[model samples]
Target: MSPHDLGRIYRSEIEEQPAALERLLEHDAEIASIAAALQSRGPRLIRMVGHGSSDNAASYGVYAFGLLPHWTAMRDSITLTVHYDSPLDLSNSVAIGLSQSGRTPDVVEYLVRARRSGAFTIAITNDPASDLASAAEATIPLEAGSEQAVAATKTYTNTLAALVLLAAHLAGEGARIADGVRRAAEQMAESIPAFARDAEALALPFSYTGRMFVIGRGVEFATAREIALKLLETCRVAAEPLTATDLAHGPVAALDPLFPVWAIASPDATLPAVQEAAQRIRETGATVVASGTAAGAVQGVQYTLPVPAPDEPLLSPLLSVVPGQLFAGALARVRGLDPDAPHGLSKVTLAL
Candidate 1:
């Protein structure tokens, strides 16, 4: 609220994530109930839809639902309904919509259509009273409280936590997953300050850069996409996100010394392949910045950002995304831009 606090709101939201996640975990009973109701429907497939950071969270949901419940999950293109008015057969499917404000028109409309098509619809959002909540048969509150910054921080992480919690319950791994989520919150509480400071320092050198790439694999690929969005929202950087394998297939050809790459790799099955990609990128003389538990383990990284190591690799996104948020805030400050007030953006975007 003061001159010195100009850029602190976004960082404060970043710091509030541990508490936000812990708060969401307290609603385990409600999440379990929703999971039970969903399971009762005997869904044949899973469909999720959102925009921007919510979309990234949906991407994570696709992986979470598949890995935990062994369910077939896919991201639904809302444009199919909003733009083309195509008939969709979503019967025997569970459709989910994730919106921080719960007012994203496209997501709400998608859920409305899915419900009409006989799918069991669920909404994950911060506000239980939002239109998105009204569109779904069930709503899981994000419990992230109020996020004033235009770029999502606590709400985004809370969205991820909610999706994982619901998926874990659906998979019958509720207790174990709950424990992992709590432990991840504890780790985040202990490490977020250092993560913020370190990420800020790590991003200072690249403040003037116009573009870069953020890479990861598996669930962490969602982490990469969210981080890239943060950088774009707060710092006005064209931070493109790609999976490590996707990078190698063709995008790697565009890398050079002037470009920087932030490779987010956790301690999981995807680590070795991500490390290989980082090594290859380094060989191209590009500046390679890495994050996550296995960040330091990656060879040829110019800088390693700190992230709390989660109890399981599946919960890694809870910890892995902190540094990228801080990095974006710091980069905005260094460039004399207000991280909370990007040139033309709002807290809630109503897209048709």
Candidate 2:
């Protein structure tokens, strides 16, 4: 409706993210020291545990660090920490638990178990004194302030930033990743207006769509998943995300000529594969909206986002996810659903 209303939502999120990011940056020295300590110990394994957006960050962290040689990054649900009674090699293991509030019972219990098992525990949370943080051997605070909305905005982005920074440090690319993240933040800030406009327009089509598909590859595969979650959680719509390659094997058959397929194709090593997958999806008669670089012929709309300079594809998710966020929020409004409340979900999921 009014520009002021839209601006309030968009700018609130944008403003809070940088503040949270600044807090993380302020503690970089401590994070680096802890990461170095863990590295020197040659942890037998590194595991990430969380739920919701925190779980998504876990996925991204695993992908980010798995690329490094000699490092094993695995995603472990909090259930695994609570239910598994088997002997784990926790003596030299590191558990990175993600929680915005740090008070989720499952997350807190899991971290406590991991700590008891002698694993090097690090809690990434907005709350410095949360139960999860208290249970952790080390805590990295996310500066994302009180997120008023049930659907997380600034916290998710800040978590990703902090996780990527941790991953880079663990992978021995701290300085490089920091530089990339800083650049990505600036790029995200610069591109927000354009992305907001695009998202507002894209929302018009998906407002009534019963279902939507988000597709991507590599790091963007997680990006697609996050977008799907945002749409479903914030927009009260049925949205699914699948790897571009995985879609052809089974999911593609379900698509019709009117199906909306949102493709995320930023410039990564996986771009070629993503582009090829987008092409194949289009052939299946699904309406395709390509949202990345390397534009090709698609049956439907094409929203080409600005390619970040110097080509740090790992950092693209920071900028790419903004449009999806806006799209989800606006689509919710179009559907007469409040983006802030969406269905029956709350900001903090306390139960296991």
Candidate 3:
């Protein structure tokens, strides 16, 4: 197969991200109305909930929204709906549920409860016909299209983009976000090929590194987790992700001379702490690779992803996770694992 064909499955998915954003923007008026209603109500709290890649998006959303003054954002559907059965303050709350397919039972159930409890609910999903979307007060469609590969690629990026857009909307910065989205889409279009090339080259070495660790701070921490999940699901490799501070607590002991570590070191307030953690991990004699926009922050092989503009810093997770997805997909191919069908996983989880 030709190189173009070999990577076409992932490349196409990556390239379509911009178009997906365009679709979202084209529907901006409807989305903006929803945002206005939600913001006008002035929710006391904001909750983002999902599973798998969607969960990762929720995690990122929490970080992005928390940066706003007096905003209470969290990822707690599982804990609240399943474990504690706690009654949330829905009278002044907005519940955002994310799902690529909008079919997850837990997500659907939680959103239903949230809505019935009087909270404004929004569904971020690719499938407009899905149950989750039907239950939501408003649906922000993720135009990622149908992803053939079980491991999500475009959907993950689109979800993060949607969440960030939602954040900007809620914060009453719709016009600014629209501008950023356009710029980000253009930058992403230019960057996908470079990302593919860089990730392909890195995958050759990654295949041999049986075990790996991903570390990041702040929103990048969620990026690390998403990367770890992608690697584990698609590459069928044992990968772990930890927060920079959490790594120092106990996980650091697992680091050794033979391990390989990947750090998502974006330019943020936590960059210093992440840089220190990367340095400490390097001291363990592990080969390290750092990916970020900043120059020379990392000591080893560094892949600097192009950033469109200095984003809300809280929204960096949307851009940071793209490289990780590419790396995971490429590494899976390098390891002779089927990117479409890893060991034993389905495209959709239907546990009714």
Q: Pick the candidate with the highest lDDT.
A: 1
lDDT of each: 0.89, 0.75, 0.77
Collision count for each candidate, in order: 0, 0, 0
For candidate 1, write residues 130-165 as lDDT tens digits: 999999999999999899888998999999999999
Q: What are the root-mean-square deviations of the candidates from the true structure over C-alphas?
A: 1.3, 2.5, 2.4
Q: Where is model 3 more than 4 Å wrong at Cα?
A: 1-8, 68-70, 82-84, 87-89, 300-315
Model 1: residues >4 Å from true position, as ranges? 1-3
lDDT of 2 by residue, 62-163 (tens): 777777434778887566558766556587789888899998888888888888888899999989899989999888888888887777778888888887
State the lDDT of candidate 3 residue by residue for 1-352, as single tens digits: 4333444565567667778777777777777788788778888888888888888777778766776434788886556774577876677889888999999988888898889888899999999899999999899998888787778877987887777777777777877877777777777777777777878888886677778888888777778889889888877678898887888898888888767777887776887887788778877887777775542576554344443333455555656667777887788767666666666888888884
Q: Please state the error at residue 101 of candidate 1 in Å.
A: 0.9
TM-score of each: 0.97, 0.92, 0.92
